[model samples]
Target: MHRAPRKKRRWPKILGFTLLGVVILGILAVVFSVQLNNGLRSATGKDTPVDTAVKSQLVRGIEAKKTGDASHDALIDKAAETLQQTPMKTITEAAGNQQKAAELVSQTTGVPEASAQVVTQAIFNDSKFDGVRKAMANGDWVQVYQQGKTLSSDPDIQALTRLVQ
Candidate 1:
């Protein structure tokens, strides 16, 4: 008489291990996607901690200048320099591409492209505020008057103008 073949019990173990592997892979993918999003935000300089700190420092320096604190002039200058060195080059460079520039400006400044373009023009227009430039270079009162004339309407620029004043 032929003996009955013993049935293998490996299917349960294989299925369990396969399910565990799939769950682990799914978790890893989720983690990786989250990290990627964070990195993209950081790279774009959107609401970054460093940007917030720099903006605060700039505001404080401007306020100090308004208070006639001569000691803070150096601080104001340093803060201005820091802001100028920030990674806004992309926004600035997009000027040649109207649509792209507008979109970038809107995203960065939270303003419509039309308004953002005006602000950008004011900020980048060196010839329009010759007096302000001179005043900034020489630390003269002309900076106060010229900056008020040139950028008084823009709160952000007004704050920056205080650095020169």
Candidate 2:
């Protein structure tokens, strides 16, 4: 006797379930991403126009320094002026977040995080460079040299001193 042919297994159910799982995973991924972005924004606080401008200027300064371009000193001076114009509280907060900022800069510029941190801290926190900023604004090389002499021993300040001069 001839055996009856077996019915082919239907794959629509398996295909449907797989599609559903993929869609669910995609939705979850989107939701997770949105939540993460919101959390970071809340943690970092609101970014103002000045904050944007300052960050852009700081990045430009970093790029200039990395390239050793002729625009290096001008870019750094512009960043300092922008920082000086920003509120003290904002400046303090930026300095406090230097590590995070460095990570971001590293990601964007492909610079090492340690080097980015050095630049960020020197730009935002190192009080030794305040005189340099002032001297830059005043076009006073004498004051820049005086302040540089005092801070020459500090590696961070030395880096900033090199940038300024």
Best by lDDT: 2
| Cα displacement (Å) at residue 151, model 2 | 12
Which ranges of candidate 2 are over 4 A from the true structure? 1-93, 120-125, 129-165
**Alpha-carbon local distance difference test for all models:** 0.55, 0.58
Tens digits of lDDT, candidate 2, 1-165: 999999886798899999999999989866564344334545667544434554565566555554455576666565555544544334333334666557655654567888988877866575766766555333333454577577768887678567766
Per-prediction TM-score: 0.25, 0.26
* Candidate maximizing TM-score: 2
Model 1, 42-85: lDDT tens digits are 57856344334545655665555544466666656655554555
